[model samples]
Target chain A: MAEETSPRGPERRRGDALLRAIHEAALAELAEVGLGQLSMEGIARRAATAKTVLYRRWSTPHELLVDALHQAHPVEVPTPSADDLRTDLVAALKLLTDWMGTPAAGAVLAVMTERHRYPELAEALYSRVFDPRGGTFTSTVLRHYANAGTLDPRRLTPIVTQIGEALVFKLTLDLNRLPTDEELVAIVDEALLPALGFPLG
Target chain B: MAEETSPRGPERRRGDALLRAIHEAALAELAEVGLGQLSMEGIARRAATAKTVLYRRWSTPHELLVDALHQAHPVEVPTPSADDLRTDLVAALKLLTDWMGTPAAGAVLAVMTERHRYPELAEALYSRVFDPRGGTFTSTVLRHYANAGTLDPRRLTPIVTQIGEALVFKLTLDLNRLPTDEELVAIVDEALLPALGFPLG
Candidate 1:
């Protein structure tokens, strides 16, 4: 846990504060004007920062948008010690659904759609926002299951990653509904537990 | 088959021919001028149709785009058979991946994202395209599984729907990769088959 902290707490705190301000400004602008109308000048004004400051940090509006998005959707790492895999997965899935249903979720997704035209934004999005949050939690859960002898070691990462990805995908693309409690339980019983070689049914 | 043909033939043929001209023109415009630059006037000019014709059929660029998308992506409903669940799922997942990875997929996704601004367009897309293609396939597959005694009778439509939705969700939202063969197999082993009370793994 100590290693997770920055060596210079004051510097890190300052950076985090700046990032938070930028992120909140981005969100406000997006909600008010929509993604197509979001401008760096508007965000800067909302944040009470100079356009120079924004330009100094990010080369373009796209980069600034991506950075703000990354800050708003910081990576989430699941803590996997909830007694059993099912309980841990339910908690994790619930968190994911909550995030997806948030205002930030729509903002992030809008940026993703825009990523088709700007491929670099896709890489930034994947590396900064998605990979850290979803990717880390997925790996942590699979690793815990393997260590507990609940999951087959060989298939652990791929199975867990796909399940996590699928949950997020459903909310973003099709259905557009948050995962229900029953659906979450089904995922645990039918997918997560069995992937760990547990007899679920 | 006769009934299916009756409603879908002459009307469909005429509709398709008109749609084909519009689609080809749209595609050419998209390639030449890009999505933001696309207009009904340009599409009509390229297709040799009046702008009024385009407007009569579709009210907005998004509507025309959706129609163009449906024309490009004809739904393929899988015939339910008593085949092994693993085999059936793999075939189905393959079709999904192929469609998502096609050239038109990005364009269609763009329209879906734009639909957020137009709720009516979003609803039309949901009923006309998304439901009939992905949603219908999911129900059909689940039904086959239930009848064959491969799925748990307790597992209802929503749960089965989640499983299907997740597969596409993962590809479009998170991993940006299609599910591999192993993943298709694992989904059945862990999620679908077990939820339905079928023994997998």
Candidate 2:
């Protein structure tokens, strides 16, 4: 225990801190000039670290962005409690908008554009980001309701899991702006819940 | 009857034919090179028509494209039959996918990118393209079902009208490709219909 804490423990903590700084810098730069114009030297200069460290860790900005996007917290999507359908949907969609609004709009666009040039990156984003965060939440929440007989068992399918996330992504990308709270509420109350067979009071 | 067959009537028919030729040329060119790089000269060359005619009718490619996007349709969205929600959603989504796949994707991107530079153009596309087609279909169809007691009356709202259209526009933009038939059916059956509270069985 003594040796564990004495030297390398503090060094490990410093290494993690440096990595965070580099990732933050990379995201900031991506938001500014976009993916095509991004440079390792520029990120290094902005990060105040050696260029060698960035090159060693990531051979390309695309690789670095895949890592950086994970840390950028567009917003946190939480698993639903056994709440009723309306409240559960509202809560889920709210998290989506929060994430949409968190990053600079340019940051998202840059990644979207890069995905066209790089298929592996697109697949990575789907696996790492899209699926884990929003995918399971809907199923878990809906299953809870289904078990209670609030929703039909057949309604608990892949479609239920994707509607809110798809809407948020679609609205943000199409409108080229994040939806306001009023818009989000209307989307949930007027559309999402009713479709899920949750008769609104 | 004699007046209907006058020389002027034949001239008007030719004029309409010319207009269609121009619109076709514009869409073809837009599909090839996209909105940004599209030129009147290029469209004229492709259509085997004169540049002066294009200039006289529509001064810019943007104006030409605005007209062309309206005409390039495999089918129009009709009011939903009371047959079932699954068929109605699939039909609506099919129309959406056709539109997305029509013009070269660059055409959509060009206009989307231009929305920031020209708010008036964005407003024009919304008023002319989006609202008339997808917007009205949802309300008209939902009201059709609701009147028959197949769907809840409250499900008839602007958000309900828009969810499938929103999802299609969003997926095409984000993925940079249109969804296939099987995927489209899955989206409609698995998600769209169920969300509207339509019983799957």
Candidate 3:
């Protein structure tokens, strides 16, 4: 812990601030060098911290990455005002899109794209980051609505839970851009809502 | 064209046979070296043909790669038996999964994954491969059913057309394997069917 204290005196990063910087650095390093080349040395260098400091917290780059991803993963707040399923679902996906704009999202993509080459990393990401946070993007909102007796729980199947994130990923991959507000609404109207037992007539 | 005659006597690749070989080689080469490093030299070497032979049919690797993808892209066949939408939709996604198992699929993914770095190649993929083939996997089936008056044409929105492929991609990414037949059926029943106005009671 001696090297944890920066030589730069008053500008030294510590506590939650230091953890956040380290997490950000890990993600940035991953984006720059990819999963194969990600190392504690590189992350430490990027964070302007000593390898000893990283070693104190995480045994390997994989562990540090899992921590970073979990720390950065956004927990969706399902605000079901007046029992509004559509608005809440849209807001959940909006949280997802907003997260997609962050550096952490890019890092997550890098890990996922190379998941086959590194199975343990992908597994750790799910257990540490995604699953603990309530599965996919719109899943929390769906569950909230279901619990409120507004939406059918049976309709909240695995396929239904994944619809929002799946479509978001598909649109992003196809368009090479985040889906627009209008497009998000269309996903809600055309896809998500109907799957929840609300047919389009 | 003189060098088009193989030095290996009776094993000479020429005409359509030669063209097919060249296309396959281009896709294989792209898979091996990726888009940035793809070259006529590598493709010709892999195809066991001269660079001159390659240049005779196509000017550059991009042109040759596009041709390869177009040649390999699968056309969905919708057999609407007794006006059945479920069977046709399932078969369409089956075609998609089958295509996903091919080398061409890998080559297409390679291009798409790095689409930003190689925008022109990505654009060529859509124009020459996807759009020309019928937009997406389930779209053709949806249209066929729509024309037969079995499905509501208005229900065939972009979001609806994408549900099958999107769910497939999502499942594959999350599970690190292609969706099983059971999973595909789930997608159709729980997501696609409902979205197309066939909600489960």
Q: What fraction of the reference interface contacts is present in each model, in order? A: 0.27, 0.36, 0.73
Which is the leading candidate under DockQ? 3
Cα RMSD for candidates in order: 8.8, 9.9, 6.2
Runs off by more than 4 Å, candidate 3: A1-26, A29-67, A74-82, B1-71, B74-82
lDDT score for residue A156 of model 2? 55
| Per-residue accuracy of model 3 over B36-106 as CA lDDT, tens digit each | 56899999999989999989888889889999988887755555454678887888888888877788987
Q: Scored by Cα lDDT, where does model 1 land?
A: 0.66
Looking at model 3, residue B7 earns an lDDT score of 48
Q: What does DockQ give for each predicted structure?
A: 0.23, 0.21, 0.44
| Native contact fraction (fnat) of model 1 | 0.27
TM-score quality measure for candidate 1: 0.73
lDDT string, candidate 1, B64-134, tens digits: 86677766767566676547766776667666666666656666565555555556757876677777654
* Cα lDDT tens digits for candidate 1, A1-201: 574356555433246677787878887777566665678898989987778878778777667777767666653557897767778877777776777677677777766656555568678777876765435555677778778887667666454456654655554455445667777776666655654556543
Against the true structure, what is each candidate's TM-score? 0.73, 0.62, 0.75
Compute the interface RMSD for each candidate structure.
Answer: 4.2, 4.5, 3.1
Error of 3 at A153 (Å): 1.8
Spell out the clash pairs found in candidate 1.
A76-A133, A151-A196, A169-B169, A190-B190, B151-B196, B152-B196
Candidate 3 global Cα RMSD: 6.2
Q: Indicate the TM-score of model 3.
A: 0.75
